[model samples]
Target: MDTGVPLSVAVSVVGKRQNPELVRVAGAGKEKCCYFFWQGRNSTVSEKGTSALMTVELDEERGAQVQVQQGKEPPCFLQCFNGGMIVHSGRREEEEENAQNEWRLYCVRGEVPVEGHLLEVACHCSSLRSRASMILLSVNRAIIYLWHGCKAQPHTRDVGRTAACRIKEQ
Candidate 1:
């Protein structure tokens, strides 16, 4: 789970398979709101209407912080990185508005020693405001459209790449 750079993960198996030590994750005051979506066969989400993939609050608290215990899960050989985003507008409308886009708990990649089974880490957002499409975690009830595997190999090593030039999507 070295999201430091070489990240090309898309492990599946959600809802009851429960292993890898029970698995538990609930950070930042138990979370409140978070949304990041990018699953093909789209329905709608390209009109540039959403943004703020990761931003709990800031002054009120909860900026970005997720933790997952366990270890050993690195073998290299993972080339599926779809990192794209070029959002730039003005920034207003209450900072991309959010009345209840609720989905707390966004970003958790713990114990990824892939081989046979045990892997469920999903978070891919690029048009919610564009920019930073590598590890943008966030979810709640659960909603993963479809992100099979492979076809995103484009690395340069940036580390937490989330840059907003001016902003648009309004």
Candidate 2:
């Protein structure tokens, strides 16, 4: 939730912003929580696009090794923050040109931190819980779907719709 200066970051594609299967670099060490940080209608990467540059703000310094993964590939670290490092993400120009079907997931935040605001769990349909709400971007990049669990609150539904509309209008 803290989008402050990154501890480290995957700034942009090494070549061009033509790939959404595009950005994410992670280092190893004691595992900790990282947050997705980007600028748009809000911080979420739930918008339609061919390429996007997004980063995670790490809570601590980098680990020994580094790895990069591409879009909707099911990220290992939800957030990246490393004050001392700048990471790059990219692919062959052909790969970028051929890329398609990439999408993003954002879970509705609960009222408190202990409730867990996870981005990865949203990858699985089985992960949809009756107590939560979520926003999903269809792979075709033309539809924004708002999903609410059976037990989700009415207020959360409104918030999800608002957030979806905000991105749609942009």
Candidate 3:
């Protein structure tokens, strides 16, 4: 989901398999219902109206990470569906601004691959604490918007909210 695009997109977990899918088509002005959680490979996401596809991969060096490929735009908003919390967020090798890239997210440990499903996002808790369902992730060229059906409260803003921290890759 690229911030450059004005279209509202979301990742929806439909049917069994709990497989995440991108929803782009809907009534005009209707926000796309979407939610996603990834800790490994083979994850599939699609763009609205186009055949373009994207994949989310976990980097052992980078805790709870989403590796967005070039020319791909992930959703800018994110929310947690089940039980989870994003601990510390690893800095992007491409971003060097310490002031802008503050370690806003932190917890007991650093990287928790096994707890991936329990931890929903990797952004400042201040934004998420705003509301229970407020848990969201901020993304850059590969922005990942997370939405949780069970935990998050309804946001007046469509498709949740943007995160304070943005992700970048080299």
Best by the lDDT measure: 2
Candidate order by lDDT, decreasing, is 2, 3, 1
What tens digits encode model 1's per-residue C-alpha lDDT throughout 52-158? 22222221332222221123322322112221221211223533464244322122122221211112222224222222122222234333222212332222112
For candidate 1, the TM-score is 0.17
lDDT of 2: 0.42
Candidate lDDT (C-alpha), each: 0.24, 0.42, 0.29
lDDT of 3 by residue, 1-170 (tens): 12111212243433333323322333223323432223222223433212122212222222222333322323232223111223333333324653464333321111222212222335554445433433333333344444333543443122233221212221
Flag the better candidate by TM-score, 2 or 3. Answer: 2
Question: Worst lDDT window (10 residues) for model 3?
Answer: 106-115
Off by over 4 Å in 1: 1-90, 103-133, 139-149, 154-170
Q: How many clashes does the backbone of model 1 have?
A: 12
Q: How big is the positional error of residue 69 in model 1, measured in Å on the Cα after superposition?
A: 41
lDDT of 3 at 14: 35
For model 2, the stretches where C-alpha displacement exceeds 4 angstroms are 1-101, 110-122
**Which one wins on TM-score?**
2
- What is the model-wide C-alpha lDDT for candidate 1? 0.24
TM-score of each: 0.17, 0.37, 0.18
Off by over 4 Å in 3: 1-96, 99-127, 130-141, 148-170
